[model samples]
Every structure is written in C-alpha cells, then in structure tokens.
Target: MEETLHWQPAATHTELLAGPVAEAVRALADDDVHVAAIDPGLADTAAFCEKYGVALDESANCVIVAGKRGGEVRYAACMVLATMRADVNGVIRKRLDVRKSSFAPMAEAVELTGMEYGGITPLGLPADWPILVDSNVASHNRVVIGSGVRRSKLAVSGALLAGLKGAEVLDLATGA
Candidate 1:
C-alpha cells in the first residue's frame, strides 16, 4: 500500500475508527483494503477529491434507498462513481421489486446503518440489504469509498468491493 504522511494507518490493531468504520475494516480484513482519517469538513466526494488531489472518477459515492412493497420497507445501498448518479427509480425499483423507491430519509438511514448521513457505506450494512455496485465501479482496479464515517475513507480493489457479501454489480449509474 502507498504511504502518505497525510493519512493515519488503519488495521485490526488500530481502534481509532468510528463505529461503522471499525466494523467495516474488521469485515474486510482478508482484502487489501486501507482506511485513513480525513477532515470531516472535506468528506463529501467533490471536496475530498479536490482537497486530497484525488480524481473524482476514482472515488465512488454510496446512497441509501428505501423501497416499499406493500407495507414493508426494504433498504439497499447503491454505489456509483462520483461522475454518475444512481438510477434509483428505473434500476433499483425494478430490481427490488418494489412499487415505490426513493432515497431514505437522513435520520432513518443514519439510525439503521449506524453511520453519518454523508458517510453511509455498503460495508457493515444490514445483512438483508443488498449492495448494488455500478458496473463501472466494479471494473476499476481500485476505488475510494466511504469508511462509514465522514471522518474517514477506505481504499480497496474493485474486486474486494465486488466480493462484499450481498454485493451485486450492475448498470446502476446514469449520467447526471
């Protein structure tokens, strides 16, 4: 892994990670993934990339969605490149087999995932929730994704993300 003075190292031995981030790091132990603390104010994709000298194309964004079928609610985490947007209504709704689907409310998403609104990631999500990764994201050699906290980020191989439990790579993104 590349070393940088700007980032603190993360591993099983480190316990500085936030709630959901710590769990994600532990869950991805077998993969060559790394996590680093970042300034919370710059955690958003555009700001993070610009401030860190990272390319927007190399970073992915995760969105939480709530789908309703009958009276029950189902959730899914959708990941796409920073350059694109997730097709929630067209792709996700059909795949989820739900009559209605939309972005989950911030409070509900944070409460359910145990992560901040801007930092909700696919990792450590509820086992029942599927993680839909865009095909472009899955094809990359490496990607920068949320660490389940606005204060940190995770770097991992696209294959590692594809191997995540409940992950399904599809054409989930569309040009904004």
Candidate 2:
C-alpha cells in the first residue's frame, strides 16, 4: 500500500471535508485513488505543483457544475488541468442538451454537492451527476484533484476516473 498522508486539518476542514469532495474520494474505495489532506489553504495548483514539484498537467481539478436549463436542469462533475479552463459553452451545453450551462452558485454548490465553491471534485459528486473530463486529462496515468475542502486533494488514475458512478468521460475543457 502507498504511504497515506496524515494531513493536519485546516480551520475549515471539518466543515468542508464532510461534503462532496469527501464522498468523491471515498467512492474510490475499490480503486487506487488516494486523498491527501494538506494545510495550504491559499495555494493554487501552480503553487502547489511548484512546492511539491508536481507537474501542472498532471494535477487535475474537479469543478462542480450545475446547468440551469430551460426544462432540463442538471449538474456535472468535471475534471481538467489546474491551469486550463473548462469549455462550459461548447462541451457542456452540447452534451446536456440544455439551453445554457453555468457554474452553480456557492450555496447550491455546497448544499447540493456537499462541497465548498473553491473545493470540489468528481470523487464526491452526487451519484446521478455527469462527469466531463478534458481529453488531455485522460491521457495522464495519474492526476491530483481537489477535495471538497480547499485543504485536501485526491490523486487518481486518469483512465479510470470516468468509471466511477455518475462520471462521464467527455472533452469538456480547453488546453492547459
């Protein structure tokens, strides 16, 4: 077994970790995904990568999304490079068959997905939510994703992330 990280809790850890990101990482019970709790509350992916020497391309971000459509409102758990932006207009709308797609409000992002706005990941998304991943992300053998809280992150296999419940492998983001 890989050495699991013993993370020191952040001030907001208890409140946020108990939500979506936690569920997502926990869902990897049968897989090799590992969630590491860290205390760098303000560290962006680039900073994290520089500090830990993690490659930016290999560090993925799980973005909790909600599409408020005309008749088909929906949610999605998307994974992309920490440096790139998700193609919300092109990829998400086409797939969801919705008139519009936008990032969910902070309250909704937290309440519905059980995750904080700055900290969301596919691992802990609702089982019915769709998961869209950038094709580049899928090419990596392993990647790191945010935990429900800003203090933690999950490292997982890119090829297998979509196999988890409610995950859909799609080209949903732009280049890194």
Predicted model with the maximum lDDT: 1
TM per prediction: 0.91, 0.79
The lDDT values for all models are 0.81, 0.68
Model 2 regions lying over 4 Å from their true place? 1-27
lDDT (Cα, tens digit) per residue for candidate 2, span 24-96:
4444444465556655554467766766667788888876666766666688877888778888777887777
Q: What's model 2's TM-score?
A: 0.79
Top TM-score hit: 1
Q: Write the per-residue lDDT of candidate 1 for residues 1-176, one digit (tens) a residue.
A: 22241444456533545576676667666546767777889889888888787788999989998998888998999999999999999999998999989999999999999988787778788888899999999998988888777877877777877889899999989996
